[model samples]
Target: QLRETLGIELPTNDAPPTSLETATPTQPVVPQSDHQCQSNQDQSPEPLDTSERQNSDLRAQSTEPLHTSEPQNSDLRAQSSEIIPVSSKEFMSVSSLIRGRVKLEDVNKTYQMIWTRFKEEGKTDPLTPGDMYKMGLKVTGQTGEAKLKVLRALKIVHISNKGAVKLL
Candidate 1:
């Protein structure tokens, strides 16, 4: 019944053992001297035709310099302004403080605190919603959604439907 269900036929007790089943374990082969190892190394297989083509492609790519333009002054300024530097501790505290009662004045103060912390840390990148969540900020659920809406209304932060947070 089990063999039928599994779609496999098991050998009966009366069946003779196969060569594989009768085989004995053997010791692994190891080179006894460096001469044998050197001979083995000398017999290295030639590179495949596909590998040669890939190598040529890589060489061509390496010869071409990557183009990267400098960020515009306005773009730099906008990016710098958008990045709010709040520590994980401050973020958690502020999130908890504004949980049930979200006041604009309190939110503004919290933003200032975060900005100060960010400056102290010297991080210039904008904090994403994933980063905030990692720092213990719950940006899901009913309360989390409400808090995000309040923060957005006050122009403190913008939370995208796709879970991205941009601090303004």
Candidate 2:
């Protein structure tokens, strides 16, 4: 039961979805220029797939009130009406760091944050999976490696066999 609540490690057996990079042509490496960012920002991102649609749909269905900050699993916090299993509940709580049920969107925002941070650091190279996962912790505010796993599950980011982290 404790292992379930503390789903700190994402099992590698449950593979992530096919990233947009593989789904479409390889995304050009993000250039290190403000102009490049501005131009790209002007263009909208691609449409969501069936899995993404289902994920967003589930988010919208949550009747729970939005928390200014996500609720921590400790004493002093009020519990919600939905009582899921401990393991499932803990993982979903990671998504709760986001404003609404739409966690995939939050993953996108987190990707942009990572991209911008890398550019600001004057690096054009993709971050290593460890570095990117560390960045995920700050951007998503999900403890342990839950944020990394969530991002993987949503197909917003991918960590390769060589440990390179790519935004998708």
Top candidate on TM-score is 1
lDDT of 2 by residue, 6-90 (tens): 9776555556765543455556544557675576658888999999999989888785665757544332111432221223444
How accurate locally is residue 145 in candidate 2, as Cα lDDT from 0 to 100?
37
lDDT for model 1, please: 0.56
**Per-residue lDDT of model 1, residues 1-168, tens digit only:** 999899999987988986566656774445457675576657878776988989989999978965659643334434674544333333344444455654444444545544544555656566666665675665566655555655554445656667565555
Question: Model-by-model lDDT, in order?
Answer: 0.56, 0.52
- Stretches > 4 Å off in candidate 2: 1-112, 118-124, 129-142
For all predicted structures, in order, the TM-scores are 0.31, 0.27
Query: Where does candidate 2 have its weakest 10-residue lDDT segment?
Result: 76-85
Weakest 10 consecutive residues, lDDT, candidate 1? 84-93
Clashing pairs in 1: 85-118
Runs in model 1 lying further than 4 Å from the true structure: 1-124
Q: What lDDT score is found at residue 163 in candidate 1?
A: 58
